[model samples]
Target: MPTAAHAHAHALDLGRFVMASPSSFHAAAEGARRLAGEGFEVLSEIDAWPGGPGKYAVVRDGALIAWTVPEGAGATTPFRILGAHTDSPSFKLKPKPTTGRLGWLQAGVEVYGGPLLNSWLDRDLRLAGRLVTLDGAQHLAATGPLLRFPQLAIHLDRAVNEGLALGKQQHMNPVWGLGDPSAEDLLGVLAEAAGVDPYEVGGFDVVVADTQEPAVFGAHGEFFASGRLDNLSSVHAGLVALVQAAEATDAEGAPIAVLAAFDHEEVGSASRSGASGPFLEDVLARIGDGLGASAGDRRRAFAASWHVSADAGHAVHPNYPERHDPANHPLLGGGPLLKINANQRYATDAAGAALWATVCGEAEVPYQEFVSNNDVPCGSTIGPLTATRLGIRTVDVGIPLLSMHSARELAGVQDPWRLSRAVERFFAQAG
Candidate 1:
């Protein structure tokens, strides 16, 4: 169990991380920056890798993979991986982004994932992502409180207090300013923020983000509210654990610890940098080759490996108790969640559950089991995909949250710190 002061400190750091990571690309870059600051060398895919007994990190688009190799690591040394995603549900900017009618300057956007549409209404928004130049240079851009999606006044729609209906095409466009679309170029705004010429930008991958800063509120200061907490919470936990594991002095026989933060998970994870893609495989293969691992040796190493897939799970909503499993009512501050799904939506099995229990027990942390109601459809995570792709044993685990896909999400302040401590124990534990 973490003390209140320690938990509050961790939550403040998480808030800083969330504020720095407005987009997936920014998340990966921020992760790499932090890893580099901790003496981890940044490796480029185009360059040759110097593997063995060192800490290294690499970024592929919006995804990041980092690992720490011990002094006694060999070709058959097993790996302990923590997997998380970097993306959240939001709207993405479409091509010919500048669009408006009359006096309203609106930007063209496409719904990227399954976000709570009603929650995006009447919130301040900003555009953030990477801008690619014609010469293949990438520049990061972020606008601060530049757009808004205002709701219709109740006086106009007299059926107030009724269900709100938001059309994806007709009602989702956000207004940025009052100007003519032809006269104003939205790309110019991003280009200026990135300190690059607008004409140099050949393409872009931008998304909208909530501009509100993360807050720690609620009775007794027990609650934490922030945007993009769905997966960033997991990513931050893995990062903190990995950094601490790298600094440990007694990691003589421990397995290689890895942190895999992927992108595009909210959209089914089919992109080049997603878990379903070859980015992770490519990095692992290269690392194996550097260790002189043959096919048999690589298989032996993988056979002993373990992957912990961390994502956000639902805490029983106070008003929607019937939607959750009656026997399993996970609370916000109860600890982290060990997610289980009968239909293989999550990859946790008996063996994985046992392993998770052992890890948590060693760390002296409590955890809750999460299962969906039989009538309710359960959501999936990257656990099954990673297990299917690499044949490595995987367990699905996460911290409980209240509003899952809302523009802003909620969590218990202590749970995030507790999750990090458990992950650090997992990383240091021998196979």
Candidate 2:
């Protein structure tokens, strides 16, 4: 059981992490740093697996997978792997990006995920993510109050309230300020902001950020309003579970516990470090081979290994209940949502769902089921991708939320704690 103080502290700290992570790359680095603070060493699988007792990583720039070994043990065991993505729907800079002929230079950005476009209007925004300076120094910059998209005044566009549609390549672009516009002017502004010479900044991937501090909201403070919680909430849960499993014995007959967070999931995951690639599989294979798993033993371990693809779930919108399947819509503060889709957009199967039900029962954590309306298309996650790649049984689970792909999203304050507890219990069981 979790104490009230413990839950509060975890939720607060996790909220801060979510807010600070402006992009997937930043998310991965920060999470890895936190894990390293716990004595987890960053290692590369490109070299032979170290094959011993310690936390190591298979890192590919923004993407990373970190895990720890049993005390006084080696790779002879597999681990319970919890997977989540670091990417979310924000804007990315395009090559030769600049706009407004004069007195209105704005940054051009592409919608990363399928985000609700209008939610970005009238909000204070910031810029963050990794940038390589001309000096070859790797710097992560978090620049805020950097831009905004002032929705045309109602008077300017009377049809705005009646109905509005966005064109990603045209109208949705954010205008941060009013000044003489020039395609070449932005480099100067960025250099000034990053405290570097214009030519010294070689390249960057920055996005407009919501300036609202993440906090417990709602009339009773049950809701969490912030940024990037969709996956960070899941990452935090995975971390909590991995630590718990480390304290307990690795299932005498189970693989070691693992946590995998990859970047670029929002962009189709085609990168070398994404779920669509062999990072997860290669790492798992390394763990198996390092532990000296014979063909049969590794196969058995594969058969027994369970994965939880942690992501965020869509909660039925109070204002638009018609958009959800009556039997599948989840509500705020309900519980962990077991997401299912026959199209394989998600990886949950009957067996996987049932396994989570059992884990919830053990942890005494509440849970719910989520399915998008049949008439509408559903977004995808790393769940199915990882499941098919590793041939491992997997379940898709997450906390339900609103404005999923918006620059800022809301979730239940209670949900993160519940997820952490549930994942902890799940890993404590059969690997």
- Candidate of highest lDDT: 1
Local error of candidate 1 at residue 198 (angstroms)? 0.6
Candidate 1 residue pairs in clash (backbone atoms < 3 Å): none
Model 2 segments more than 4 A misplaced: 1-5, 45-49, 71-76, 134-137, 188-197, 249-251, 294-297
How high is the CA lDDT of each candidate model? 0.94, 0.76
The CA lDDT at 23 in model 2 is: 67
lDDT (Cα) of model 1: 0.94
Model 1 CA lDDT for position 395 = 97
Locate the minimum summed-lDDT window of 10 residues in model 1: 247-256
Q: Distance (Å) between predicted and true CA of 286, model 1?
A: 1.6
TM, every model: 0.99, 0.91
